[model samples]
Target: MNFREFAAKNVHRNVKAYFAYFLSSSISAALLFSFTMIILHPNLGAIDLPEYLIKALNITTVIAYLFLFFFVFYSVSVFLKSRYKEFGILYIIGASKKQIQRMISIENMIISSVSALLGIIAGLVFSKILLAVSGKLLGFNALEFYLPVKAMLITFIAFVIIGIVISIFCSFIIKEDMVLKLLKGTKKPKTEPKTSTILAITCVVLLTTGYYLSVTSSTKTLAGRIIPVTLMVIVATYLLFSQLTIFIIKLLKRNRTLYMKKTSVLWISNLLYRIKDNTRMFFLITITSTVALASIGSVYAYWRDKEAQIDRSFPQAFFFSDIYDNSSMVDEKVNFIEGSLKNEGIKYTKVNDEMKFIIPKGEKDQVVIIKEDTYKKLSSILYLNAANLSENETILAMPLTKHGRKNVVLENIELEVASKLDKGIIPAFYEEVYVVKDEAYEKIKGVKVYFNTINVKDYKNTLNISNNYYNNFPQDNVNKYYNNLLKSGILRATKVAYGVILFSAIFIGLIFFVTTGSFLYNKCYMDIIEDKKKYNQLNKIGLTFKEIKKILNIEIGVLFLFPYIIAVIHYIFAISALKYAFELNIAVPSLQVIFIVLIAQIIYFIIIRKNYLLEIKKSLL
Candidate 1:
């Protein structure tokens, strides 16, 4: 048969084995195509969104494509290792080294072409659904969906070129000495593998240092320390699997009593070889999985913290402000906004109030004073309790009367404390504010700040309204807060940009996880033949089928659980540092991410273990 025919037959025989890698690659292509569809959408120009958002979307798409290259490279490398013995047999039958390389290269090219084609077809099927969801999040009222010819062309060309480049690279990986290694593939080595004591100690030291640095770095220095800490952790993880794990296994073997226990004997007998052979694979999986989980967790935590931040920074949707003496000067701007909201048929309620601040004639300091009615209205909006105030009674807003002082005296006006509001009433420059009856507020002599807050029934309508208001009455020294520009701008950008980032992080994280699973799946199957031979020999020595199955469960369980445990510990410390940096309580989000990752791990472990045991059973028969 011709080389193409031979490779085609081989691929057909191994189609089931290649299914996971094929599906993951195709899905990755579809996701990339979806992002590209958004980029190519004509309606983006029709919408009035921030330039940074568009740029961020573009940058993230490119990053996804770049990530695909590395993902494909690693996956292809693992695949080549599994096929080494097959290639060695062909070489033994007088196939020239160059000929063998050519055949292998051609086979991979076929797989790549087919995988990419499947991906493009899947992309065509799902890109529109993804785009529609993305458009909704980005506040696009109507994002036109059409055939993304440019995206298709780009994806096809990019993946095709990647295939070609990787094919050439894979050809060179087979050297003269590699034939002998391939010939002995999956065979038991003459000598047992041993761990280096110094390397094991280094693992402990590096991991401890990495954990310390990750947890203790101040927010100011954390950004600068990211690279060093990441390197330390990666090196430590490698040593953990390669040296520390092997050392521990060797210690377990030396413990005669424990080693002789039920299943322990079988586990130690099998695990010693398994750990030695899979250490490097375990290290790779651990690091990659940690990165994926951490990326998703951090972004999710940030997204969750935004709501409280928005509330703190912007108490009301649209609040107008000016000196009370210049209330007339700001009347036109406020009237314009009210008229515009009415013209748009938008429902809103207005609160008109003046905050009186007492500034001593010779001093630069000021203390805010809120009238009783104003305090009640603003408190309702801010979700704080507004206590009834007698003429002499006052409630100090948060951070002001934190000391629980019963009496507060401002500018010769003495008032008894009724209660303290833990949150801000309006966005104020000073945290200290006093609540008093209208009679007391009107009696104080100070500058008066006029503020009018327009509360919308729905914040979603603010984008268009705020846009139009800015277009007409732009910010000036006298009309600084006229259109509520600062708060509205922040609201719009956060909703759009953060929405995209969080979505992208989740999408890419799942892809990384699938690739991690594919790696483990292929590795598990590749070792099945060796496991069958060894276990079949054990069967002759009176090991029953049930006992053998139990041994296999322990073996696979350790393999799967070790990396996940280490990764979770790494992520927990990473998030704790982020909590300090962002100054927000991330406990809820952290727990959520942990739950998600653990569930996914458990599901994957169950599937792999089931299939692995089936293979071993078949081998035993």
Candidate 2:
């Protein structure tokens, strides 16, 4: 047979070994194609999508490509390493190094071609669904799909280059002495896995310090310490899997009572070697999974909290500020807003109030002062309790206030501080507000600014009204007027912007998760020959199939679950840090994401376990 035929046949024979690698490459290509299609869609620009959204798509596409390169390179290296014995056999049968390199190049090209074709087809099949979902998130009614020629070309070319570069790079991985080493393969004796006591203790200390910093640091300080905290956790996690885990397992082995339990001796002995061999895999999975969970969790939490954030920042449906004291302009705008609301059959309440900006007797900073009657009216409309104040008494409405200050003197009037409000009743722009009794308010002399705050029954449905007012009286400063509809538009735009990010994050996370699973599966089956021999010998020594199955369960279960548990621990600390930094209560969304990932991991574990057991059972037959 010709060299090309030989290479093709080799691939067919090693399909099982190449399957995960093929699947990962194909999926990576498909994702890149789909994202590119969305970015290049003709309708995308027409939809008025925020500029940042487009930028985000481009950035994520670049990131996906980079990840694809890393994943492909890593997978190819692992696959080649697993085939050392096969390479040794070929070398012994007269195949030169140059010929072997040529064979690998041909085989890799064939796989890459087929994978790229399948991926393009898959992208085409799912393009409509993807566009539809993206359109919905972006608030576009329709994102019609046309032929994605550009995306196809980009994806195909990208993967082809990656395949060529990887094949060439991997061809040089074999060493001059690899032939003898590969021939001996599993016949080489393994020394006991060793651990450093110092490193193990260092791991504990680093992890403790990392978790403590994440949970206890204030938002202001956390920003500066993010890099340090992340580095600590990452280093600690590596040591945790490499040194700490092996150290603990060795300690457990020293316990005679626990070590001698039925079947415990069997699995425990096997687990020590397995954990040592797969330490790097475990670390990779844990770190990548933690990143996936934390990213999706943070974005999901922000999306869920968008509405409440708006409510806190904009307390009323409509607010008009007469900053220039232009009564005619204010009157005209208010009339148009009220007329539009009435015309749309919308129910609303309007409250008129004037704020006086006054500097205290000696302080340069100005505090906003509003009368108690207006406060009562606005509070009643907003369904909040109004402060009860007597003459010369005031309520301090400011964020993060200290209660030590007793009173304030504005001009000649002295007002006793009755109580403090953590958040402002009006818009958050008026940072410090003093709600004084009408008698006290009239005595203070300062620049008076009139404001009209309106609360509507169905505020969300006022987009058209807000648009009409904006069209008629377009204002330059958005802060002067708070239209619920306009504010909601901004919120929608923000959602669309973050929604794109969240969508990309979700897909990236899922890709990471699936790749990790594939890596674990490949690692398991790579040692099938060794496991077959080991288990067959045990069978001949009177170990029953049932007992073998029990041992397999413990071994496989730990192989699947240990890394996942560590990832969950890491994710908890990450989400906790986000909570403290943002002051957001996101437990519900965070838990939901964790639960879903856990379910997916459990299902994947079951499938892998079932197939792995079946392969081992063949040895018994």
Highest lDDT model number: 2
lDDT of every model, 2 decimals: 0.75, 0.81
Model 1 lDDT per residue over 299-409, tens place? 878777766766665667777777866687566666877887888898877788888778633446577788889989987765677688777888877531234468877
lDDT of 2 by residue, 1-621 (tens): 999999999999999888878887787778778878887889887766667777787888877788778877777787788888888888888889888888888888888878888889999999889989877766566589899998899989988888799888987886545899877754668898889999999999999999999887664577887899899999998998889988988988999899999888898888888989998999999999998998898888887887776676567877777654665566567778888888878888888768888888888777789889888988899887877888878888764323445799977888788888755578766657889888878888887887776778766787777767767776564542332234545566667777788888877887788778778877877777788889999999998889989998888888888898899998888888877765666899989998999998899889878888898898899
Which ranges in model 2 have alpha carbons more than 4 Å from their true place?
186-188, 217-222, 320-335, 352-374, 389-424, 429-451, 468-485, 580-583
Candidate 1, run of 10 with poorest lDDT? 477-486
